[model samples]
Target: MSSDAPVDARAPGQKTFFGHPRALSTLFLTEMWERFSFYGMRAILVLYLTASVAEDGLGISESTANAVYGTYNAMVYLMALPGGWVADRLLGARRSVLWGGVVIAAGHYVMAIPARWSVFAGMTLIVLGTGLLKPNISTMVGGLYDRDSPRRDAGFSIFYMGINLGAFIAPLITGFLGEKVNWHLGFGAAAIGMTFGVLQYVLGRRNLGDTGDRPADPLLGADRRRALTRIGVAVLVLLLVLAVLAVADLFTVNTVVNSLTIATVVITIGYFARIITDREISSTERSRMKAYLWLFVFAAAFWLIYDQAGSVLNLFAADRTDRDVLGFTFPASWLQSVNPILIIIGAPLAALLWLRLGHRVSTPVKFAVGLVLNGLSFVLMAAAAQAAVGGDLVSPWWLVAVYAIQVAGELSLSPVGLSATTKLAPVKYASQMMGLWFLATAVGDAVGGQVARLAETWPEPTYFLAFGLASVALGLGAVMFTRHISRLMAGIH
Candidate 1:
């Protein structure tokens, strides 16, 4: 696991392609099944919430459902902070992933139970579990190779493809089952997928070896003790606040959950600030870290638009799109797969395009391009929304086209941002810095949900326009700062 050790860039029994380790397959399958479970649950969650009570749903209003969707998705990303912390400081990524899988499995099983209370409890557990698993698993992937290893980017691409493969399939299966048969059955299937992921990780332990274990630094133990103590105090204070809010009738369960989530976000931001501003970090590294923080904020805008595939877009598919195809109708839920489908097809082409333009574009320029494309996708959707006026169902092709454009944007930004973070993060705090990167994603998700909720208060066209214009503006701003940011990443890569 030493940085100098040569990677086994081959299939288990075949020749290597692009110098990536064969052990990547183990990580790939594990992530694939985990995403299958996650996306499957996501495809059905909004529909389940807004469907009729007679159908065993929450029967919430559209705005409320979107709010719930936004909050849940936000919490999922926010949890990654603690998940990474636990992995880096206490349990190590391997054990944390194992335990996270267990928690997620249990949560999904709870969702499969036939009660409103079960739904609440199950979703909470799943959010917490995801926080623990997502960041740690990603950190482990970076661990598998040395810094600036030529294979790193390609390995991440292959790994991301696995994520899309699971995502592409999940919505089709879960969406159909949830809409056509029973919602809980779809959740049950998701739980089963998680079980498979857990099993794969357990069986593939040797492939990971000591890559994700605790660092050998003697100071590591003291840091872990301090972190755990702070976490414990925070949890206690959160519980006390929840109790007070409930007694005052100012907090339903959802309100308490939202407050805790917001608190977690604030605390995480404070933690990163403390680390970056500390005198211990060299001045040069501090400048690079500041650049990373800026990139994170810009990347958050991309996620805000992209993640709508699960929340606002899901609702649009269910309510406004033409689901009928050749005399057979497809479930609106299945449309959620469109983004991943496009990603699977467009990723290679996007990669080639980047290679061709390597000398012409900086990472920030590519990110700006991504943001603009993502913004345009929403504008296209806005046009579709206008066409769907007077209760008409717009052609499904419109949704497909939007997802295709959005995927193109994703290819330009998401993977590149990940690479940039690792390269720029100081070696001593790499895992924690990556955790902050994921936290930006959490913030974007929360903001997306809020945007969706606000849009729910307006006409469809207005909502689309708002999101589209804001995304374009964000992209333009990022491009303006590209030169300054590039200077910060100087000498890192």
Candidate 2:
């Protein structure tokens, strides 16, 4: 279940499917299709970029491609800030999600064109569309049940499962189209998925009632006009700046990556400072804030390690690892599906473990465990590297094993971490903490790209071993300091 699923949006005495609200079906399908489109496009993006020009690709260097990939991923999370604001103050969640899907479909169609500018324009539109859609869509799922309803968590769990179902299937369909037929076809498939999602949501809108028909905090008429005008001006300025950069060739790979890296660090530090200095919070809350700062650190490290499943790890599957089975070679993009598959299988078991052992296990302890598991995945990658060093193709199980362990770490860290943030959040800063969580993810992706680029500097075994050990050391350090962080958490588990 998504811990971020808002409790305030509950529906009462509502009709249900299987004891949960009937509206969940529509919302679930919408999210499922949206994720399918998003992950489907993502599954093939970097591969298309790095493929040779002869193969209808841009033929960019690996380092540059990694930087672009990282920057794009980071932008998605960062954009959520403005996205949520826009939904709350201007367009209600319904309109935002509806238009977001339309924009996304248009983006995909743009990508289907053969021009390089189409790729850039398509990705930009998708990012903008996701910003509008991603933050607002699942919010309605939270509103599907009454506040006191016991089924709310179950509904969110089912909703979460639906999203992952699409994630698991995306690579199979899009990856096959991208790797076998045409990359543009893969993008087109994503567009088709979004179109279906939009249609479903439209048909099912009546079930939603007035859940997101109006903004929670409505703006006055003049203020609304002013806000919209400012928004338009900001967007126009941004476009003009981007156009200038592209025309001048100032949109270099390093410039993009370095800018995001700096932005992440500065914003992260500023958020920490704001929390620590806030006078309205209690001393204990401040202590917990300090502790979450540390959590933020490990969170970044964990994502830095985990996100490689799509970057360096994907490349490894394509190059070093053997994909052949009885002369039918597997598509490299198919490997992108493994983590989501494991998460779908593992999340419930982990949730149960936490329920059974919530008090016995501390938040810091879980973080430590998650960190260690992520570290161990890289260690397995190192082992894989060693096996393939002699120029023999390694077993596909090597990459599969790494993804399995990493998914375990994700199960421990991701959802659990979200829950912990909500519980530990200061009264005035609850939403801010959620944004901070997104910021950590943004930082992780930006830094992860730079780290992936360094794979070129060292031999495979050394590269894997070095980062792997760093993670293990961090995990052990987190374990050793568990009691201290527990103290700082002020009784939060």
Candidate 3:
């Protein structure tokens, strides 16, 4: 392996214990606290919106709250395109992350103010802040390791654990404070968490060194300019369309659907145009890119189900669950902790299981397993939903079980798909390729909100059943196409 890009500026012959670098610790803590704030606030958002006006909530209708929740979450991921571009092109990842953290902290503090306007402003800032922070941070994590280092996967798994750890604890603490006392207090707590994250990242600068330093190569400049131009033009067109819709009073469901449809068409055309115009890409590389695009479609299905934990599941717990355990009733918001808790417990074991099953199982096979497991989790939830019909409460254990199974699926797919992205992406367009990957996630989150709103009209069992069956079918389809994808991934190993 080449030593061209040294992650940590350590002296020669210095030992890294447990096959990982020291800087991992700093990044770990930084991400942990960041996720702590994000998830903590997320756990309470929908519940706070839908709570009675007498309880100090805005008393927004359930569907509207879900729409806002979904749109906010979607925009958070969508903004990463610009965030990643800015970091890779001009600001560098380290500075972008720091600025992002500051913005996020400010956003949370805005939410802490006791006013509706403040809440809206805070959410807007948070969405933009997350766009800046989230993708850049992950890129920094990758920068911490040398390319082709065997420890890369292990390091990412460890980083993923840090994410879940914060997620696990945030809701428990924040939910308690919000439900038992004041909602603003919970938001304030999240602000404090982000503040700590910012402090830690700032203090640990030496550990990061120049890993996210700007590229010295001149060729990157042209790439950056082209990407920016494309994005700017797209945004301008979108804004104009939205402006026209607003003026015409067409900013309704049909308008949203049309906007999304047009966005999809534009993205499709843009990708194909890149393939035609870029002479650097080989036929084989183009084939691999096509496969990756398909994987993005599959991933959208997975997130459409998984991202509902904050919106629909939170509401389900508040309205339907028997929250009492032992003698005391737990806050409904705390149910958001279930998936993270399961991730914390199940991730390492799942990694070990995959390693043991390695050689016997292909990556595509594992992906299929993940999809099936995710579907089964929804099936289990569907059963629970049926049992809980007619306003009767169901056992909390059912929710726990569902989350556990879903986490199992997440463990199988999330890390693996990230690894696969680098393997399959064309080297020249890597950042944009990753942007598309995140765009799929954004679409899924937005759709998840729409799916959750269906519960208002349809039986919960029907919603779960439909999601479960679609996931399973998608998984099976991926399995059937495994050979083609494997061929695309030929050089990765």
Candidate 4:
């Protein structure tokens, strides 16, 4: 839920869904379809990029395509910072979500048009729309329950299920249409999913009571005018810069991606500096922020490998994995579903394990566990790549096992990292710390995309093995400093 949004009293005799707010069902379906559109497009993005031009594909080089995928993911996460601001100060969460869904639907519809430029244009729109929609909707979910309600965590758990469910189902639908039939048709399917989400969200608003009905902090007349003017000027300046780059013949896709990647890293560093140097915060708060920096590095490292599943591993599934079952071959993108399904199955079990263990395990230790497991996943992938080196297709089970390991790593670190971010944040920078946490992902994806370029020049097995070992070494190093990080945490679990 939004930190600034006012929580309102529930209406008397309000209807409930499974003893929770009736509005949860609405938000649940909204997020489900949004993710359906997102993952559905993602599952086939690289495959579509590298497919033969004769098959109506882009035919871009594999390394460039992988970089494009990474950069796109980075932009989506990066935008969330501005997205949250728009909701808090201008449109409010409800309107931001509504408009965001509309734009996302429009993006998918644009992709469904079979022109060469539509793909890039559609992706740009999707990135902007997702930025607006993603964070605010989660904030709205938080608004549904009081800060101290026991049901709050459970509500988020149910919401988490919605996310994984969409991810698990999207590739099966979109992958089949994109690979076996027309790619545009698959994109059309995603557009339809988001449309359903928007329609349902609109119709279900009555159940929401006062949630996100207005901005948390609306600007006054003169201030609003000034803010709007500044926004316009900023947009114009950005456009002018792009035009200059284009005129200079420096506006190629790779150039844009490289610029954005560098910008993401620079912004992350600046944000950290701004927070840690703030005179408003206490020494203890500063110490916690210092510890958070280490966890941020670890989180970035983890995502650098985990997110490659859609690019490097997707290509592997297509080219090297034998997907034949009972004489029927499957779409390679279907393999993307494996990770989400495993996440769905493992999440409850993980929660149980953590509950049973409680604070006996420290945050840094769990992070080490995650990093080591993530590294082991890639180490296993090295063996799979080696098996395919002789032009033999390896069994599909190799990819399944790989996703299982990655999911375990995700369960160990991702939620724990979010919890740690909240616990360690200075009071002055509490909400902003969440944005910093997301920046970790943006940084990882940006750097990882650049790193992926080496795959084109290096042997596949060597690429996997080297990174795998590096991550393992980082994990072991984190273990060595666990005591120090715990002390820096200053009573935070």
Candidate 5:
């Protein structure tokens, strides 16, 4: 999504291999395999961290594991800004993606070696690699289709399907091995998955053509030196901060988690303030940006609810949900796949439904619907949690239903929000605005992690119900403001 490339409907000469562009296929499969590694590692990270050392895990506390998960996920998105900057200034998306792939595979493999030092080191590498890969690759995908091309939305959907395909299968394989066989095996599987993505990417680089080969604004000699120096300074400062924190006995899980949460929020506010006050945009553009700011709010809320799948709900599935289906127990990591599987099945149908009725469905209305659906999912989970308060395991269907509802919610908010983001972004700061959109996710995920950390402290029913009610209330509030937000959108729908 980090792209400021001008829309060109110029016929892609010699590029009509998929009823659109051959590059879309290459990008799609690369991202699919990339996501396979990502989601595969994610599916078991918290579980591995919190499991007993006897089980080949780190034996961290549940709260610590959840916090680490939250912070890791948060950094993954927050780094996209600098990663996109690197591409826009020096590396270009293709090289960034390639290097990112290398780092990602290395990270997974490191974690596969099974040691105390490897855990944090591997996570840091994945975070950096993901930061480099995610936004730029998404920008490349957007670059593949012209703005006016009808295939643009469809292309993203197809691309998204590839992502889900990876997500859907990753857990079935990695989850089984990680949870049942060995955690290191699962991590290694994730590495292998990324290896496939990298090999395929190299083979198909020609298909990518010159889409993300050049910078929108190339840096001059002085600018290049200053940028590199700044990166070095930033790295030094970060190391110093870590050293200070260690000296103070404050380099703990909560410190890192809370600091990141604050950082995400501050960055979000700064981005919105900058975009809204920019003189380069027209009044209409400014107003649309403001509307986007609201979308950011709703989006953060949605993700805060959604991201619990990896932390709170993951733990629930492991300990609280009955996976015994006719005496055949399934791995808890398999629970992560249910959402992507549903998304794979439901995304196309949702796309079709939107194509048929998009004219009538306002963006805010879609966001409102998404919020309501999200709340409903938590409501279902809350009921299950209530039923299980007496030390009974809830039926697995409760989780399935939660994921199914969330799939609907995610379909509405995520895709619509992505389109709305690019549409509403100020042209001068388009890539940064994309980074801002993901900042909302960073905030949500960080906050969700904090909430998950508290899960053990609160009664299951109360925790679920409180968050569920909050979501429903926010949804209703958005519905009430739909017309106002639409007016501010300045002709974008």
Candidate 6:
């Protein structure tokens, strides 16, 4: 078992990273730079899509851009399912992370090439690479400590800080370059960041020891061959489908985005159905999974409204927010930094608040709180939109306020959901349960992308008000069902 692996992959006299394993430093830095690249690119994606072709932008409609953004996010999360499987069965976490980083760096470099087709091509590669890297890195981090070690939680907390730190810094650098200089130059910066992460990861492999040196559950000869064949067929089928679409003149962005959206929905429904109907799981486990279904819905709904930060909200910042600071206008993407910065500042505070509340608050109640706060943020956005009427630009503080509220909501729900997934997961499907959690986000982002088309068609205030109230109503409904969901949790806190 991985628990038996060396926690400190260093000579006895060697230094440690803040008294934890030296390996923590390696994984931490890898994750940080990876996040830097990811968020840096995301900060400017929609802006680039909607900018004039004369200005070296894609010239896509805002609605199409939003859908593209949503679909892109959906795919990134969705790939984690197979990504984990590959780590467990084929490449092992170490190789998977290494290759994933290589692919990710390549993707960013491709995006830096300034060709129209390169953006989409690069995004596809990035999604595939991210899927492989993201989940496995966390797994390796977990391998560092025993299951019940107190240091395990502290280690993850430190790792979480790395994520937010990278996110906080990315937009400042990339936004300036992309908005002020060339969009491709900004993407090139992201490429450089990932390349740094990859190089350092390789150099720091000595610290990793044998943490993820081999597969958790490696497939053997015949089975491995079958799996590889299946993967090959899947890829072939996908390419063939694209070829057919192009030949039929139906390979438009909208067509592909809509199709992927529908597929996400179907995959989610099928995933749930397969698990719930499984003969291997016990009745008690089935009941718990049933409760998880509700949580999944709540999580999906929460992300639907929350993830709009990059698309609808980013556009609002660009077009409707007054960015003038003593006649120097800041890039709209700079606002993307607000969420991570707030999270970094508020995460500890939220942890303390939850510690004080303890079991009295209940998971469902906390989720309800998250939903309400998320909705309230959007409700405030409606007011901001109203203020921007008559071709007037509102203060940038409006967005800062919105992101602050959303961060509060995120701090309340995200960590709690991850904890709950681990607690409520069926023993037989433990790892896959994490995949299901990621799917909840995928479903939300995919659907939210389709929903965002309304932002372009409807009045901004009405659009914000309707969705805001809907989330509030869902939160209230969650409040009403708390006791029932609690019972279904079957003693899980």
Top candidate by lDDT? 6
CA lDDT of each prediction against the hidden true structure: 0.81, 0.84, 0.79, 0.91, 0.87, 0.94
Residue lDDT tens for model 1, 320-373: 988887888888988888888888888899878877887578888888888999
lDDT at 299 for candidate 1? 82
TM-scores for all candidates: the values are 0.90, 0.94, 0.88, 0.98, 0.94, 0.99
User: Between candidates 2 and 4, which one is better according to lDDT?
Assistant: 4
Candidate 6 residue lDDT tens string, 314-340: 999999989999989999999999999
Clashing pairs in 5: none
Model 3 stretches with alpha carbons more than 4 Å out: 1-22, 213-269, 272-279, 488-493
Which of candidates 3 and 4 is the stronger one according to lDDT? 4
Q: List the lowest-lDDT window of 10 residues for candidate 5.
A: 1-10
RMSD of model 3 against the true structure: 3.6
Residue-level lDDT of model 3, residues 1-493, one tens digit each, is 2212456434575445355666677788888998999999999988888888789887877776776677677778778887887786667777788889999999999999988777778987987788888888888888877777777778888888889899989999889988888888999999999999999888977666576756322226677688778879988998898799889999764357435534543664576567535879887778777777667777777888888878877788888889888889999988788888877777778778877877677777777878898898889889999999999998888888888888888888887787677778777877677777777777777777666677677789998898898899889999998888877766553
Among residues 3 or more apart in sequence or in different chains, the pairs in candidate 2 whose N, CA or C atoms overlap within 3 Å are: 9-143, 11-145
lDDT of 2 by residue, 114-176 (tens): 877787789889888888888787666766566667777888899899889999999999999
Candidate 4 per-residue C-alpha lDDT over 1-493 given as tens digits, one digit per residue, 9 for 90 to 100: 5433433335577777667788888999999999999999999999998898998899988899989999999999999999888888899888999999999999999999998889889999999999899998998998888888888899899999999999999999999999999988899999999999999999998867678777888887998999899999999999999999999999999999999999999999999999999999999999999999999999999999999999999999999999889898999999999999999999999999999999999999999999999999999999999999988999989989989998999999999999999999999888778888989999989899888877778889999999988998999999999999988888888
- Candidate 3 positional error at 252, Å: 7.9
Q: By TM-score, how accurate is candidate 4? A: 0.98
**Which has the higher TM-score value, candidate number 3 or candidate number 4?**
4
Error of 6 at 458 (Å): 0.6
| Candidate 3 collision pairs | none
* Strongest candidate by TM-score: 6
Supply candidate 6's per-residue lDDT for 251.
Answer: 99
